[model samples]
Target: MSALVARPFRLLGEGAVRAVRTALMQAVSAWTADWGLAPALVDVDVHRAWDGTSARALAWNHGAQSNGRRAWLAVGPDVATGLQQMMFPADPSYGPVGSATPALAAAGALQALDALLDALLRTSLSSQHNVPRCGAAVPATSWEYGSGALVARLAFGSRHFHVLLDGPAVQALVPPAAPLPALRAVDVAAGVADVPVSLRLQAGTARVGVGALLSLAPGDVIRLDKQADAPLTLASMSSHPLFHAYLGRCRDEVAVELVQSHTPVGEVQ
Candidate 1:
């Protein structure tokens, strides 16, 4: 029902878009943390409205595999200005931090942030995620501000920046994230097997009289009201039920054959 709805990459599933947003947030947080700022990830939202004069966009080809496919990531003025203030001190004299203009601040801040993001992409994010960035520092004079722009709002405290990318740009750069935790399950399974397992055979239970407990001595037989067909419960050291089994013998050794899966009360599995 909006113009951004008509954009190309908006059709990319939430996972892909979320991965891109997460990468941006990580870059932003790392950049801020280096400056000694305790930035928190607040929210990431898709926005169609854009009201800013400063923007920095880069067009890059994703190598030969993409047949020279080009895409861009644009930054809005409000966001850039916010980052500039948060990143450096607000010196009115323009001494150490440079100028005070939003256009200049946004451009410079974005350029610096781009370098940090590049390093992150090389390290944690990598090519599998497919995020994009420009080679050199983008000048403030290069920004183009207009409408119909798709923006992503990365909010941290009072900081807010819009990542402007066309639908096609996102679809090209963003890669599909693995659908699961995606670690080495085989290693995990092998380690899990080595862990010690314990079993319990609570044949039956009774609320006996205190006199009966005190009278226990050698050569005394205590009869428990247990049916022979009743199953025994297998449990972990932590007392978590693993399975239900029936009493039996495997040739020479006594055994309790598993009969059914066990689920604790209020637990689905």
Candidate 2:
């Protein structure tokens, strides 16, 4: 019951499956056009089927990684046979296949799958919304192809195949998403204009026995771990080191001249 209830949510993209499916199908169609092989995507979903497992597959790390990705392809006995018949130069029945079944006859099937996946990825990148697509633009070089690891089980027509993409390969396919309803600009000066902070003048240090410290009088001085004339560290109320300053006197009052900031310039106070 739990698995049944969770499957849909796991597969569906916040009720955006239709849109995602359509986009993926379009991308696949554009690529299969070269071979006149329309291997449509019958069903697609994101899953953790091969999250950390490695298997015999044509998989390789692709581009820089920023997120997770999984790609599955399934080609059943019949579909595998059909694909082989159409794509391979020599018939499956000829040469070494001899008496093997269609599923077993998918000779050079890995190469075929590699080409299909590569094409789909390129087309997918090209189909990005408003992303420039022209002769000057190159289809993304983000796909890392190799053999090992089962990432997905593709279901298209009557065929079933297991395809996988490593973490890096997935990164190539999906770009980092930008925040939606982008943050609006606002004046920040007023919010932090007047804030109280802890300004300390850390002099020097001296370690003494408890007995020696207790024996001290009002005229005694306990040194700290700092040095004379050393820079002072100003800390915020939150205990965050804020800045380094130099002890000085401004006009007639003692003050500290800010010497260096502890954080980046644009960081909020």
TM-score of each: 0.32, 0.31
Residue 202 in model 2: shift from native, Å? 32
- Compared with the true structure, all predictions reach lDDT values of 0.52, 0.48
The residue-by-residue lDDT of candidate 1 on 1-269, one tens digit each, is 66554322233445655655666666667766765666563366653323343333333212111222322333334555566666665777755336544566667777766664353343232344535555433223223233223345656557654444443334444675558865654655556657665666777766778998899899987776777787777776566777889888999998888888787544422
Encode model 2's per-residue lDDT on 1-269: one tens digit a residue: 35543211122232232333344556556646755665553444433332333333423323211123333333344655545655554665666557766454375555565565554444334322222222221112212232212144445555554433333343344445567996878777766668554555544457899999779998877877777678978776665777898878899998888889998997865
Please name the candidate that would achieve the greatest TM-score relative to the true structure.
1
Clashes of each: 1, 20
RMSD of each predicted structure: 16.8, 15.3
Off by over 4 Å in 1: 1-10, 41-43, 47-69, 76-80, 88-151, 155-159, 165-269
Best by lDDT: 1
- Please report how far candidate 1 places residue 97 from its true position, in Å: 16
